[model samples]
Target: MTVVAHPTDPTPARAPAATRTAGRIRGLDAARALAIFGMVTVHFGPFPVRGDDLASAAYRTPYGRASVLFAFVAGVGVALLSGDGSAPRVRSAGRRLVLRAALLFPLGVALQKLPTGVAVILQYYAIYFLIAAAALRLADRWLLALAGSLTLAGPMAIVLAQRAEPSWFDAGGNVGIRAPVALLRALVISGYYPVLSWAPVVLFGIWIGRRDLHAPGVHRRLVACGAG
Candidate 1:
């Protein structure tokens, strides 16, 4: 008796290994550049026109909102750079994170001394890198769960800390000078871009990465999400 090939049988030509990696998404790059430009404008305090109040709406309106956009875009960048769920690629990404963190830590500390009351986001970005490293290793479902829980817990943690006495975690005082520990705590608590609140955004990016962004449907989804 002769046996026939089954319709469900795997075909060598259709294997994933046969496909090449997708090209970089230019739209994402453009979005990132725009985010960076907005961040600069927000941080630099407008054009500082002569004899003006220097506190015009253009500068004030964008300051906090622009920084939040930058943080969200940074999360997308992290997800894009990790090549979605690929392990080997993410390991290399983790190394890059360490190098960037090492370089930015000192600069961040120095910037804190300035009168502007700004905490350089690179410091927080570095801490996010460390958290992402661990988060990336988990299953996608678990990653999302962890991200959601942390996002909710972050504000509550700060609230509880505030009520607990001493209040070292509060946004005032010498808390900025404590180096690594301070950096880690700020990333979780007082900072606007706290890791707990922001990690879910990154994990969302990771989930986005799992989809085929080059597809028209995916692009539309991205636009909708970005708009929201």
Candidate 2:
């Protein structure tokens, strides 16, 4: 006797990658909003404290934190722009990032000319975009390795450089665009946020962004790691 064959149920169709990608990560948005708020509090808060508890707390809370969060978010953006690591996508990202750097460099320099009292981090941010563009083709493992290497090497180099040229590091307070060499030095090593030390943060962010962030497993891991 012949046995009757039964058909298996068809698998459900999942959303396209692009469709999933288009959805915003609310967590990132919230983090970004917090960073922005902190930055504003730090920048625009009343100077000299004047015994105001709220102002004192605001300054204490967001002083160093906001800028770092901003840089990490910027790195995440770089990873998103790289888009699946395809050659064409990478090339497109490179162009867009390069143009952003170009725009930001000049704008940042111009901002420095003002008597704003704050060391504008825009120029350093521009350099970071340039670095991210250059490393767009690197694999995630290599990116992680590079970031770790930079984190160690950068501070060591800074110490050595400071010893070698104490005058260079000592001459702080915003070098002007007219002095290209000095400006370059400040951006690389002497500025408020030197690219060398900060690059690791950006690179790590890119690595995080490169992951399957849409996955619940990833979300849980990230949340746990962040909380820890």
Candidate 3:
């Protein structure tokens, strides 16, 4: 999008241009702000509070769910910003995603050294970014199918890996620690929103982006879906 100026009505004070721009998507920004707040609450640790009762619930609720929503919105934003069916623009966008992933992978590993347990989302996000970019050129139906299949198959794959003989896929056991290689390995595993399962959300976002958000009856259907 294009940002347009709105005339002030009967008020002496004027809102900044940036503020006006932000107001266009107040809903999205509000949702993002709530997600950030939830993240801070989850990461703040149970200092004044204790045990896994409320704390665990908080961690799994609003925070985890909001983070996933934010990721999906991010994918939608990417698709919207990249334009429709423009190969060169998509490739350029993909290059930027690759660069971001390269930077984030190391940062994610560094963050994992902190006291917040071994689980880190950035590494998985980096991997997702790269994979999603590769799949961007495909037809929407194909993209949707691949994403849906991978997401559905991921749990089965994990279960099979767990049941099978010891191998690299056995993520349960202890492993060696070379910071560089470890980061790469963790990027491949040790995360809840694994690339296989998470790509579908991004693909769904792409599908939404290709549609007319302002079309009559569209928002109603979306609201119904959200309700369901």
TM-score versus the correct structure, for each prediction: 0.73, 0.86, 0.71
Q: Report clashes for each candidate as comma-separated counts.
A: 0, 0, 0
Query: Per-residue lDDT of 1-228 in model 1, one digit per residue for the tens?
Result: 111225763311111211113777777677677767767777675754545465565666566676666666666666566664467877887787777777876676567657777656666666766766665566555655776787688668777866774355665412455565765566676565666666666666554554455668667867897689
Among all windows of 10 consecutive residues in model 2, the one with the lowest summed lDDT is: 8-17
Judged by lDDT against the true structure, how good is candidate 2?
Answer: 0.79
- Candidate whose lDDT is highest: 2
Any idea what lDDT model 3 has?
A: 0.60
Off by over 4 Å in 1: 1-21, 47-57, 169-184
TM-score of 3: 0.71
Query: How close to the true structure is residue 26 of candidate 2, measured as C-alpha lDDT?
Result: 78
Question: Candidates 1 and 3: which is better by TM-score?
Answer: 1
- lDDT tens readout by residue for model 2, 46-89: 44376768768778788899999999988887877876667888
Report every candidate's CA lDDT.
Answer: 0.61, 0.79, 0.60
Instruction: State which candidate, 2 or 3, has the greater lDDT.
Output: 2
lDDT of 3 by residue, 1-228 (tens): 111223642211222223323324544566578778776766674423456687676665765676677677767666655554467867887888889889876676567667655456776677777876776676555666776787688667656644773354544212233645544443444345556556677777655554455444556766787789
- For candidate 2, report its TM-score: 0.86
